[model samples]
Target: MSDRVALVWDDAFEAYDFGPQHPLKPIRVVLTVALVRACGLDALPNVSAVIPRSATRAELETIHDPAYIDAVERISREVADPYGNYGWGIGTGDDPAFAGMHDASARVAGASITAADAVWSNTVEHAFNPAGGLHHAMADHASGFCIYNDPAIAIRWLLDHGAARVAYIDVDVHHGDGVQAAFYVDPRVLTVSLHESGHFLFPGTGFPDEVGRGGAEGTKVNVSLPPYTYDDAYRAAFERVVPPLVEAFKPDVLVTQLGCDTHATDPLAHFALTTKTYRYLARALHDLAHSTAGGKWVATGGGGYQIYAVVPRAWTIYFAELAGGSTPTELPAEWVERARAEGARELPDSFDDHGVILPRGRREEVDERAAAAAQETVARVFPYFGLR
Candidate 1:
């Protein structure tokens, strides 16, 4: 297996931009690459920034409806979703019709598919597509700033290529509803999502009772963590849930959605994770990939609203861990200045985020909620996986 980790990127990826007012700003990605360069990850022998091809319509159709594809194409040309009857979740402010929307979304999916192909073909043991992981996207609709579900498409492609089993783990603050919905009844793909409880989050699904259907029971894991869940609570829940289920599933490949919005500084979401805690999560996932799937892992980027202070550092830690390099404690001063100039509201002196303080009388409720959610996942799904 090649030692290098494929880093999927292209100059046109910034075309996935929604607009300046959108919370899922493309500048976060730009700042991530900038920090990667400042830390010399792009130049690392173990990291290769591979250019990606835009996915063809056929590839996209593997996970999206043909009519939806046609709608996206039409919107790309018209620069607006004129037909509101498709019911594909277009024509909304969240998924505004932008110029080249189809091409850009396809490009993100293509990068993820290419990364999956590389890992499966043994061209690379691991790959990271920082531009991919549009997980909230349904098969036929755009939602949560995602036009197409890249992680789901990549997982489906793996199954179509004769892979017996694939395990998808999502760490986004929001539920990985799209990916879970994609493979809810398919035993070949196992999707595990750990996010802030849908009771308090957007899209408002991912309850424990919504496990996989039919033969895929216990295959779909959702850890609905409580609000204000700190690193210790989050880590405890994660360790209690993911590792055992992955071990039981014994997947041929591992795909992870590493969304950084769980950080306290993120403008969106309520998880209280620091960069130091994020490092542990990254390392654990990296190790899980090796231990569970013969070192085959495809990592994708997802929701993170803190473009300046949080995302750059969180993903820098992820990349550093994935590429077998030490994390840079402090960002370069020049890069910090440049990041601020480029609209990073608050850049960090170090990679670590300041810890979030839980207000008085909040700890018991938070811990109880966390404990219940974790127990719900373990209780509902572990027996099906034969771990109980």
Candidate 2:
């Protein structure tokens, strides 16, 4: 079997930028694509760059209200008043309206759909749309810096295209509420999200109790860890919850939101992860894609604000894994210099951040809480999959 991987990207993705001050910067995607080239992953024989087209109004309507789509289109034409609140979750501090908002956001959604089509058609063994994974967009409004809810849109596309089962795994520090909401009452798509507890995060949802509704009960799984959750605990929770459920679900395709914001250095959320966690996650997800989903995987990028130091490196690792390649531990000199020229201040010299240890007392407290949360999540949802 060929390990062909499609990198769904277009330079127009930079048009999705919110503003100079927004925490969600386009520089992260820019740096990630640059590092992919710098690491020579783009030059591999099995890897190919695939430029994507914009999502059409009909496609966007599959996951968004037409009124909301119209609102975004109308808002995209005018110069945004930073303080203006045009409703439909636009022009707010989180999802500020800018010119070309609809075009850029629709392009992201279209990119994820392109990845899904490629994987389903067997054109590639896997596909990664690094500019995609705006998982926080709602049918009627946007939230959490997401405008199009690309993962959900792509999942719906898969279902429409004869895929009976699709599994979505989200590891961002924020709950994948929008994706969960999209399929909460449908059994064909299983949505699993592991993130910091809603008590401490934005959108404030994704508890163990938020299982799927009606016939889809037990299909929507959430492992909400406490703040300060570390690499081991998070990975353990993922292992205990995600793999078992995915195996049981037996999805026809696997989709992932590879958000690297759980890194300790991130400015938005609280989790003590290092690049090691991302590396582990990439390897594990890659293995699962082959084992359970017949090697059909569609991956996307999401929340990671540590643009200079973390997001690029973490996502570069993911793309390498998807392409059946490995990255050298030493950071390339030219790439480091480029990041520095782009205003990077505290760059690491290698691909990995060995991470930091918390004080013993704090470590023990956080460990215990995270373990309990993971155990509780397992105990709550395991019965649904017939696992003890």
Candidate 3:
């Protein structure tokens, strides 16, 4: 197996902009790549960035309707509002079509599909597309600032390329509802999502009881966390649920959605995760990939709006760890200045701002809730996986 990890990226990915006022700004991605360079992670031997092209229409049809694709393209070219028909959720406040909407969205999807292909083909043991993970887009509509469901497209690509039993785990603050819906009745793909409970979040779904449909019953897993869930609670829930299920599923490939919106510093969500905790989760998932899926892991970026304070630092450490490089204790001074110039006022001076080590002991109350919920989930689905 190759020790390298492919980092799928390109400057064109910045074209995926909703607008200047939208919270899901493309600057987060730009800053993330800059931070990776500032931390000297770009120089790591095992890491290299790959440019991606827009995905072909056929590849997009795997997860989206052909008519919707055509609508997006038409709106992109005409620069007119098709809000009545084509805008199931498009041209709305969350997903406004820009000049190159179709191409930009397809490029993000292509990056994810490229990463999936690299990992599945063993050209790289692990791959990451921090530009991807637009998981909120459904088969027919866009929602929650997501224009394309890249995770679903990548999983479909994996299945087409001779893989069976693919497992997808989503850690975005919002539920992976679109991806779940795409595979809800397919036993071949197991979708597990750990997110702030849909009761309090957008696209409100992903209830624990809503595990898969028909013959694919129990193939879907969800841990609907309570609001204000901090690092201890988050990690406790993950430790209690994720690993065991992946082991039971025993998938041939592991695809994960690593959204940083759960951070306490993020403006959009209520979860209170720290950067240290996020890094820990990334490292844990990387380890899980090696153990359960022969190191075939495709990681994607999801929702995160705290552009400077959280997203860049968190993702920098994540890519560093994935590249087998040591996390830097301090931020590069030049990067901090550039961020301030770019309108980030609260950027941290160092990557160690969190000042806490990972795998922090689980809190008693959080542990109890997580344990109880996990136990219930296992009981509900363990029989299906024949793990009882």
Candidate 4:
């Protein structure tokens, strides 16, 4: 197998637009890829750009209901859903009906699935799909600006192909409720998420008690952090949950939802992480993939609304690390100028926003709260894996 990583990209992925005003903008992915090129990630010897094929109906049916799939297609074709009562979570405010919604969403899912295929087939040790990672779409409904649950479908693909232990780590601000629900009772898939507390976040439901059911206990781990948690606390919380669980599970393949909305500048949620924090997390996950899963890692992009300021910068560095390259202290000047010429807001001069997070105090309190959440998760979950 090659040490190269697959880079899944396509221009059509921009069609996943909810609208001009929706927080989940596709331009973020575009800017990310641009920065990847600007920083010479695309020219790396170990990185391969791949144009993915859209997933088929049968492929999607593995996780989505056929009727719901049909509803997505219908809404994509018609201006309005012919069956308004379908209740498939389409045509709503968050996920409104749009042209080519199903095709675009399935394409994103396919890009992710293709990355998974490469890693599983040993064609590549690692892969990335910056347009994928719609973690909030449920079995029969779309939520949180997501259409099809691509990461869940890819994990299902892995399970069907004889991988006994598949581990998923979601670092998005919102709970990865859709992916968790998909494999909550399946012992073969371990889904771990670190997010803002459900009490304070949207689509909120990733608590310590959701540690899978029956045979799958300990397979679902959640570290719900406080709203204002900064880089050190966030990293500490992530380490407290993810490393131990993944080491214990010893998965066949590790899939991650790399959502960058945890930054303090992000509009949707309240996390004080900077670009430096994103780099640390990505490098840690890369090391864990090699240490735990023999380097079989498939990562995808998720929720990041700070398109100009946060998403592009964070993900560009992340892609560089995943491609086995080093990130620069300062962003390429050409990309910053391009962003400015395009009228981007808060065009960062360097990868680090250099923002201070803890001037308001309460670091100890936040750390204690996060530590308690991790302990509760271990108390409820670790015994299933014969730990603690």
Candidate 5:
């Protein structure tokens, strides 16, 4: 078996920009690559950078409607509004229709697909697409800054290629609604998401009760953590849920959306997690990929708005773990200089966040809410997996 790892990337991925004010900045991915290179992880003998081809219309149709694809294409040529008049979530505040929107979005989707293909074909045992993980996207519309649901499209590709089963685990702060919706009724695919409760988050839909509808009933699992969920609480909930279900599912390949927006400093989400949780998650997911999915893992970057201090470091930690290597203890001097050159501030000196200390009055409330959410979620979905 090929043990090499593929880093699916292309410079054109930076084209998926939504203007100067959008939180989902393309600089996050660019900084991630630069950090990885600076840390010399890119030079590892087992790691290889692979340029991706833009996903063709037919391939995108695997998860998006043809009409929606046409709309995106039509809107890409127009410059009247950053947000397109075209429906299907196009031209909205969250997902503005930018020039080359179709090509750029398709390329992001293609990176994930390329990662999936590399792992499935044994050209590589693992792959990471820092530009992919547009999970909030639905079949027909853009949502949550995602134009196409690359993770779902990639999972579908795995299914179409004769894989008996596939498991998707999304760790973004927001519910991975698009992916869950995509395979909600397909018995062959299992999607598990752990995120900030939909009650207080955008797209508000990832409750425990939203399990699959028919034969796929038990396959969809969600852990709706409360806001202010700290590193320990978040990891506790993850431990209680993800591993057992993924192991039980015994999927041929493992796919994950590693969005670091769960960081306490992220402007968009309320989760209080730190890079410690991110590192823990990376190690845990790495173990699961090896133990449950034969090391066939495809990982993608999702949401992380703290472009300088959080996103780049968190993803570099993730990539280091994905490659079975040690993470750098200190941020490289060259990377810090480059980040400053780009107008970044409060750049971290280390990979791990010091910690998140909640106010005295808020600690109890946060822990209580977190514990209740985790317990309720386990109670709601364990029976389906035959787990106590």
Candidate 6:
């Protein structure tokens, strides 16, 4: 297997924009790439960028409904309200239709598939499609600003290409309900998500009891955390659940969705994760990819709203780590200026804006709450994996 890693990217991915007001701005991806390049990560020998084509209907239909695909295409062409039987999650508040919605969403999906294909085919040891990870889209409908379930499509691609076991780990603040639902009954795909509890999140689903169904029982793992979870709490929750389960699954490929929206500065989420903690999580996941998946890993971007301050820095560090480069503590002034020119407010000078390090010092009550919650998750599901 090749030791190089491919970073799937193209400027055309910015066309995935919903609108100016939408929180899921495509500029975050742009800024992330820029930040990585500014930090000299693009020069790394292991990290090569690949442009992706739009996913064909056949490729998309592997995980999405054909009618839904048609609806997205038809709605993308219409100038007026084309709200017929089109399951166009279009015309809705979260997923407003754009002219090139199909092209953009399909390109993102294709990017994810290309990453997975690269890793699985031994073209690269690891791959990242930071523009992908629209994990909220279901087979039939779009939800939570996601139009195509890129991770699910990529997983399906892996399965079709002879992958025996693929483990999907989602660290987005919201549950990865779409990906889980897509493979709920398939034992070959193990979906593990650690997110804010469903009670306070959108597309509210990933409960402890919502483990995989039928033959896939015990394959679905979720650690639903309380609202005020900070760095240490987030790390503790992940440590308590993810490592043991992934070790047990012994996947042939590891797919991960790293959404920076869990940061406290994000406009949409309640989690308090700092960039330091996110870097630690990325490193941990990367190590796990080597340990459990033959170093075959595919990473993708998910929901992150703090475009200026959080998203760029968080994902830059992630890509750096993936490329085996050091995470720079300081942001390039030129990159910050470019981001401002692109309508983003100036970001902080350093990646560590919060001052608190990994295993943050939280209030005792919050720490206790997070610890108790982690214990509850392990108590509920660890035995299913025989991790006792």
Q: Hey, what RMSD does candidate 4 come out at?
A: 1.9
lDDT of candidate 1 over 199-308, digit per residue (tens):
89987998888898999887888898888988778888889999998988899999999999999877788888887678898889988888999999999999898878
Q: What is the Cα-based TM-score of model 5?
A: 0.97
Candidate 2 similarity to native, TM-score: 0.98
Candidate 6's C-alpha lDDT? 0.85
TM-score of 3: 0.94
Candidate 6, residues 251-304: lDDT per residue as tens digits? Answer: 999999999888987888788778768878978999999999989999999989
lDDT for model 4: 0.86
- lDDT of the candidates, in the order given: 0.85, 0.91, 0.83, 0.86, 0.89, 0.85
Scored against the true structure, residue 240 in model 1 reaches a CA lDDT of: 91
List candidate 4 stretches off by more than 4 Å: 80-86
Model 3, residue 355: displacement in angstroms?
6.1
Per-residue C-alpha lDDT of model 5 across residues 1-388, encoded as one tens digit per residue: 2258898889888899999988888988999999999988888889999999888888999999998888888888875788547788887889988889998999999999999999999999999999988998988889999999999999998999988999999999999999999999998888888998889998799998988988998888888988898887888888888888888889999999999999999999898989889889988998999999999999999999999999999999999887766667889999999999887978877878788898867877877777788788778878887897
Q: Which prediction has more favorable lDDT, 2 or 5? A: 2
Best by TM-score: 2
Error of 1 at 345 (Å): 3.4
Which should have the higher TM-score, number 4 or number 5? Answer: 5
Q: Can you tell me which runs of candidate 1 are displaced by over 4 Å?
A: 80-87
Residue-level lDDT of model 4, residues 102-138, one tens digit each, is 8999999899889999999998899999998899999
Give the candidate order by descending TM-score. Answer: 2, 5, 4, 1, 6, 3
Candidate 3 per-residue lDDT, tens place, 163-209, comes to 98899999999999999999999999999888887788887887788
Most accurate candidate by lDDT = 2
